[model samples]
Target: MSANEVFLVAMLIIFSLPWLVWRLCRTDYFAPLVVVQIVMGILLGPGVLGRWFPDYHAWVFAPPVVQALNGLALWAVMLFVMIAGTELDLGQAWRHRRESGITAGLALGVPLLLGCAAAGVLLHLPGWVGEAAQGWQFVLGIGMACAVTALPILILLMEKLQLLRQPLGQRILRYASLDDIAVWGLLALILMDWNRVGRQALFLAGFALAAWGFRRLMVRLPEADRWHVALIWLALCGFTADWAGLHYMVGAFLAGAVLEAAWFDQARLDQLRHHVLLVLMPVFFLSTGLRTGWSVGGGEVFAAAALLLGATVAGKLLGVHLAGRVLGWPACEAPIIGWLLQTKALIMIIFANILLDRQIITSASFTALLLMAVASTMLTTPMVAPRLANRRAP
Candidate 1:
């Protein structure tokens, strides 16, 4: 088949298979359609599909086809990340600063320390650290990956559980929002190149001046034009950041972070986020899967995943539980909040992807991190549902 035909075939598989499994199998209770899409991506990757059906995999994901998909995936994730940044509600977090700070601090810090230890263990072994990474970069990258709370995914899960507008749900959002900022900040640090320090500094200074003008212009524009301008801003920031030695994803997040959520209609913002997820993000997931490898051995990769999963869940819970004690939150609230905050699907994957792209972590490490992310996300609903049900039953 021609490259176009094969690309279409790949696209068909990317969209259709996940939906079929999600619908026919009725996995929504434990695994949402997004989760299934990620899992499906893994299965269709070189590790599984290529291993089992090399010729077919090669034909379908030919160089041209893969390139086309990657182009789509890059734009898709940038839009998604920008939406996440735009939706951060830092005003709310500031209003509840004391509580938000405490929870976000522990929720991120504890897992980070534990994950660093886990990284230390991996450092002793081969095939885990990337070739270009310094020791500290590898350790901190893994640590932050554990600490991530996928704010977007958390919002989705809370919406699913019918808690999105509840007081508790809003509280969770505040905590996650602060952590999201910290996560991105740390990512920028990890991706820092001493050789390009001057360039990065210049990018930040220029970005600040540009952002001020951009915001001034945005508020004056009609809503219809704001959307077009936002995309232009996204493209420009992404390009400038990539050129400055920071990853384009970092720039994407910053571009959105500076914008006010109130500038856009809430419903419209939600629709934009939803449509991006529905239409574009599946390609990103598949591209992510293609990057996963098990050169360190499948057993070792799974073991590393399990290790990271334990550290992530345990550290998040322990940290939140500690915060509950200090903040005088009810006993039951800690576990439910902990499980919910531990959701790490899209954001963690994005974090690990940047690390891999920068060569701060190997594909083997990426595979392990990917597996850990999927498992942690799947655990969120199941773990939180029973606790929520019991709380409401009385």
Candidate 2:
């Protein structure tokens, strides 16, 4: 078969298999279709399919087909990340400064510290640290991954739990919003290239000017025209950022960050995000799965995954509990908030992908983190259901 035909087969497998499993098994209560797709991606990856059915895997995922899929995945994820950025409610967070600041600080900081300690340990071992990474870079990268709350996934889960529009949900969103900014800022720091420092500085300066002009122009344009302009802007920023040594995904985020979400209709924006997830993001997930490896050994990879999950879960609970104590919240609230905040899915994976791309972490390390993200995300709906039910019981 031609490469295009084979690529279509790959896409058919990617889209249909996970959806069929999710629907047939009714796994929505525990693992969403998105999570299922991620797992399927790993199963289809070289470590599994290629190891078992080498010829079939190779035939289907030929170089040209894989490259085409990757191109699709890249843009899908870039748009997804941009939407995530545009949804940030920094102004709302500022209005509720005291509560948001305290919670966001502890939630991000505690996990980061604990994850750093775990990274420090992993550095002593084989196949954990990337060859290109400085000791500190690897540690900080892993730490931030632990600290990340997948805001998009969190939003989805909250909507499922019927908390999305509630006061508690709004409060949680504020905290997550602040932390999202921090997560990306740290990513920029970790990915900084000393050799390209001048280029990066130039990019930032140019971005500042362009952003100001863009915002001014957006205000003057009709709302219907703004969407097209934003897409053009997204492509431009992504190109410039990549040219300047920062990843295009970082550029994608900045493209959305500079724009005001209020300028867009909330319902339309929500639908766009949903459509992106439903259609394109699964390709991104499959692409991510293709990157997974267990070269360090399956047992070792699983062990690392378990350890990181423990650190992330424990640190989130401890951090939120600390915040509850500091703010004198009802004692019962901490566990619920902690579990909700511990949800890690798309954002953490995206973060790790950047690290992997930059060679800040080895494939073994990426595999471990990928497993940790899936497990933690799967834990969310099951863990939160009972607490939410109890809260509703007058």
lDDT of each: 0.95, 0.93
Flag regions of model 1 displaced more than 4 Å: none
lDDT per residue for candidate 1 within 1-394, as digits (tens), equals 7778889999999999999999999999889999999999999999999999999999988889899999999999999999999989898999889999999999999999999999999998999999999999999999999999998899899999999999999999999999999999999999989999999999999999999999999999998899999999999999999999999999999999988888889999999999999999999999999999989899999999999999999999999999999999988999999999999999999999999999999999999999999999999999999999998896
Worst 10 residues of 2 by lDDT: 330-339
Global lDDT for candidate 2? Answer: 0.93
TM-score to native of every candidate shown:
0.99, 0.99
Query: How much does each candidate deviate from the true structure in C-alpha RMSD?
Result: 0.7, 0.8
Compute the lDDT of residue 31 as modeled in candidate 1.
92
Could you tell me which 10 consecutive residues in candidate 1 have the lowest summed lDDT? 1-10
The residue-level lDDT of candidate 1 at 69 comes to: 97
- CA displacement after TM-score superposition, residue 58 of candidate 2 (Å): 0.4
Over 4 Å off in model 2, which ranges? none
